[model samples]
Target: MTDTTDTAKCPACPGRRHPRQYLCNTCWRSLPSTTRGRLARRDARAFQRLRELHRALAARTPLAIIRVSR
Candidate 1:
């Protein structure tokens, strides 16, 4: 038997996240387009940028105000 209910908690809200996603749909859509673009990029610095996003979220920064370095 396999567990299909494997989901992770959203960092920004109480919503659940799909295994391969960083945030819930609502929270992901709430982010600014620029930030979203930056986060979508997969490069050598991708993990660093993700950490920046997580740090900002941990600080309770608004999604609109969140910025990840290029």
Candidate 2:
């Protein structure tokens, strides 16, 4: 079985991310509240929203400037 406790590197920075999470604490906290709220929602569009976040991050977009569509 896979280790659920393993830590992974954060995509936005060199910080360590907890297992099953997308970003490290610092990086996550840096995101705008609206973005965080949208990401927290568990709905059919959740995956698509996550893709938007990841795409922004991959493009080196600033956390405060990142916006996800509904």
Would you give me the overall lDDT of model 1? 0.88
- Per-residue lDDT, model 2, residue 4, is 39
C-alpha positional error of residue 34 in candidate 2 after TM-score superposition, expressed in Å: 0.2
- What is the C-alpha lDDT profile of model 2 across 12-62, one tens digit per residue? 898778966778889889999899888888899999998999999989999
lDDT of 1 by residue, 1-68 (tens): 15336778888898888867778889999999999999989899999998999999999999888999
Q: Relative to the unseen true structure, what is the C-alpha lDDT of residue 1 in candidate 2, on a scale of 0 to 100? A: 31
Q: For this target, which candidate reaches the highest TM-score against the unseen true structure?
A: 1
- Alpha-carbon error at 10 in model 1, in Å? 0.7
Give the alpha-carbon lDDT of every model.
Answer: 0.88, 0.86
Clashing pairs in 2: none
Q: What lDDT is reached at residue 23 by model 2?
A: 85
Cα error of candidate 1 at position 4, Å: 7.8
